[model samples]
Target: MISRAEKSANYLILVVFAVFAITPILTVLQAAFGPSDAGGGGGFGNFADAWRIGHFGTYLRMSLAVSVSVVVVSVLLSILSGFAFGVMRFRGSGPLFYLFLLGIMMPSEAIVVPLYFDLRSLGLTDTFWAVALPQVAQSVAFGTFWMRAYFRSSSRALVEAARLDGASTRRLLWQILVPLARPAIVTMTVLVFMWTWNEFLIPLVMVTDENLRTAPLGLAFFQGQYTQGFTLLAAGAVIVATPVVVLYLFLQRHFIAGMLEGAVRE
Candidate 1:
């Protein structure tokens, strides 16, 4: 239990951080709904103009397509790989596992130039696949590491019992491992969704077609033109931020529990 002073400090910290974090969002909100004329009163006209000019409905669809697909694929693959590496023992496991650990340490910016050429060779450049593939790869490294840690500390007796019941490898994972590992899975899903949704640099470099641009890319363009469009930009920011906020709200407990499990295991 927190003391009164500690609670007060916590609120103070929350307030300060909220202001700091919300300053840009507020600016965008103002631009989105702010005054239309040079020095006129605030109104909803800017949001209307931005909506029409940005083709935001289409961009929202593109963002949903890319982000949802990336999250699903990334979560499924990470669970499979993390469980294999965490629970199963085989030849060359140590070395291969460390290779993945190395990938977690590597920064996306480091190989982005090569990634560009690699995508170009595959003829996926400027497509949703180009962005999705790299983002998935980037997420897998850390997701594997984190999920692996969670699986490592999970109940061994349950795994053994499942094996005794004649469960196959795939069934054990899907039926037993995943159910027990729900907290970690939810945490990884939230984190990956946030990253893939807000990602800008990769999409900025990979996608040239305006129609295929994700929300972040569209916001960048909107900001460039509507330099003073605070209210409209705020509305856009709200739109872009809504999904992740809702995800965190739903998964907050799972996220915290997963983090605690990893910390204890490590």
Candidate 2:
């Protein structure tokens, strides 16, 4: 139960946050559709022009390719590595796990110079794999750590039952752990998708060719080349942002549940 004053305060806080969140978005939306001479000769017209001129359709396709590939590779690698660390005991496993954890603390920028040089040496610079492989490597650390925690926290009783039934490692993971960890898997998938979709710096450095540019880099190019057409840039921004926002809205429940229930008590 709440008092009238408390309810008023709560509503006031909600209003404040709403303004904070919506103001820029509304401004962009308006700019996206405003009439010409709304400060520039370009308006929603600019959006259509940019989309066609910039070949944003192709860029959108390429970005989706990179994002989906990153998510799939990252999730698969995380699951395997996490199961190894969580369920399989081996020599030096603790140290190896800590080494993976170190990735979480380090910024990707710290190794960009070396990474770029390495990719160049491998003839991978300007390739889709250049952007994707690094993202996979970087994301793997946290993804494995997260999934390992989820697996460890899940029912040991079930694991024991499976073992008594003579379940092999593959059987346990495929038949038991994977199904039970669906919530955590979905959360990690969304997180990886969001990260890879929005990733900019690595792609910017590695992919010098225009055809290989990710959406964020494309947005940067749009902003730079079409400075007067703010509406087009705004529209582009909205296009890039919409998919992840929709995904989050859909999977937010599983994401929350996974985080809450993920870590094992040791």
Candidate 3:
């Protein structure tokens, strides 16, 4: 049904957008591998130098710990809440679910000031919980929305069958529904992990200790100190971004499937 002109136009549009998106990344790659004034090194050597000079080893560990913690806590809470909202209706459930959606609509920047003051009051400033807790809350909002869509559209026959088999609510969820929700859960996990890993505003405001600095936060300070060192800056950017890239690559299939399913169902 499509004309050759339409196909060509589509390809052309895609090519243009691809170049637009890739240009900055390619520029960074070039800067990372190109010669620098700090030293004669290029390529991987630049990464090593950046890693050493930036203390990214500590940053990487801190980021992983915070991100992983956020993902685990957020995903679990989202799943439980999603199951409740989607399958087990109760009093005032609609209002409560809407409250959760408000979280998704709220901007982090809007809350950063209040969040910092609250954390300071609790004496959680400069601590891992300071970064992880807010991110967990944000991620759970989206995850609940995502998983609730999945559960709402899931097979009612299977749920009824589980009930007839005398499966308790917790057992039914974990032993039956959880396995079938793998694609959706994996997709949610990947997304939450990415968000938590890339989050900057919360970590920047909450923690001041160098040892607790996440990769992105550390990269910001590293850029400040090495403003003239383009090669090192580029290399540090690559280092900070690589884990997210690798994670997406590994989980792309599930993520795509889950997204398509969510789209069709919604």
RMSD of each: 3.8, 3.4, 2.8
Instruction: Give each model's whole-structure lDDT.
Output: 0.78, 0.82, 0.87
CA deviation > 4 Å runs, candidate 2: 36-47, 254-266
Q: After superposition, how far is residue 45 of candidate 2 from its true place, in Å?
A: 5.3
Q: Compared with the true structure, what per-residue lDDT tens digits does model 3 show for residues 1-266?
A: 99999999999999999999999999998898887657756778889999999999999999999989998998999999999988887999899989888888788888989989988998989999989988888888888888888888899888999999999999988988889998888888887787788888899999999999999999999999887668999999999999988987888886666556533211
Residue-wise lDDT of candidate 2 within 21-131, one digit each (tens)? 999889987876776432545665756766776667777887899999988998999999999998888999999999998886677788889999998998989998988
Can you tell me which runs of candidate 3 are displaced by over 4 Å? 1-12, 253-266
- Model 1, residue 182: what's the lDDT? 74
Better of 1 and 3 by lDDT: 3
User: Ten consecutive residues with minimal summed lDDT in candidate 3?
Assistant: 257-266
- Please report the candidate that would top lDDT against the real structure: 3
Ranking by lDDT: 3, 2, 1
